[model samples]
Target: MLTLTSPVETAFHRLPAGVKLGAVALGSVLALQVTSLAGVGLLLAGLAAAYLSQGVVFARAAGRQISGLWPVVAVILVWHGWTGAWAAGAVVSGRMIFAIGLATLATMTTRLEAMLMLAERALQPLARLGINPKAIALAMALVIRFTPVLLDKAAQLVQAWRARSPRRAGARIVLPVALAALDDAEQVAEALRARGGL
Candidate 1:
């Protein structure tokens, strides 16, 4: 998962999830206008301050989550560098960092159930068009809830492979991970049926 809500008693955790989510959407829109390191740096600086207000550990967790896309970021930077478009690469990477960073912040601060309730309320207008917003809300909540679990499982599999093999895990753990995911899905399906289906 990109973010898991911290149990820390931060002020942001007390705010309405809808407000934070709206702000994140607006922030993402503004992030797109950033075309220079200075603009991105300003945003990052502000975010850093906010995170730091929560605590050093909260800030560190956020940083780790942000770094997960380093491989993709590296490719963009290297490709642009090779083509002599270093500035463009920086802008793109910076935009990505800002956009994802804000979204992750909102995620980390808001409880998953609160987010689901807010999303369901926000989607109510779609009900007029015959859409089942509750179902959508449930799906979104499930994704938010399980994404971190899935990532952890993947990491554990990789670690297990590393412990048993001299070489890197790489693609070797894919099959096992797939099977684990399938098992999770089956369990979810069974539980949902027992609950009378969603």
Candidate 2:
């Protein structure tokens, strides 16, 4: 499983993990608040400019991550188009693009350890209500870590399916992807046990 964190260093990478995550969330909220498609498009363009400032390789990596989301974006646009809500489709897809782009940027800039620490700190206040913050934080961190890995796995599965079929294999790989995810979960569980159970 590959990490989503980009190798290209930038000023954003120097910021605190919690700060980056907060910025991502705030950006997403602002993006969603825009009812106009053009507004969301501008937001996306602004994000793209920021990404571009990080250099060509950084921009390309970000582009690939955003492009990987084509399937879901296509569905939203097509469904809205069929339902005679083209504006809604544009706004929805545009919001998704910006939100996903912002998240990808945060993950690319922040290290996994930093993210984990931030999560743990954020959850600590919940411990007063009998919640084990460490355990919850660890779980959240693992999910965040594996999300891109699973996406990469799905992409590989799609590529392999395409190699053997003339038609696009869309949802056909769902079962395999699920099974693979389960296998990953099992491995992570074993690792946690070996590490003395968080």
The top-ranked prediction according to TM-score is 1
Against the unseen true structure, what C-alpha lDDT does each candidate score? 0.85, 0.88
Task: Please write out the lDDT profile of model 2 over residues 64-176, one tens digit for every residue.
Answer: 87898899989998999999999999899998888899999998998888888888888889989989988987787778778888988999999999899999888899999
Q: Which regions of candidate 1 fall more than 4 Å away from where they truly are?
A: 1-3, 160-169
In candidate 1, the residue pairs with backbone N, CA or C atoms under 3 Å apart (3 or more residues apart, or in different chains) clash, namely none
Cα lDDT of model 1 by residue, 108-198, tens digit = 8888788888889989999999999998998787776677788799999988888898899888888888888789879988999999986
35 in model 1: Cα distance from truth in Å? Answer: 1.8
The deviation in Å at residue 150 for candidate 2 is 5.7
Which number leads on lDDT? 2
- Backbone collision tally, model 2: 0
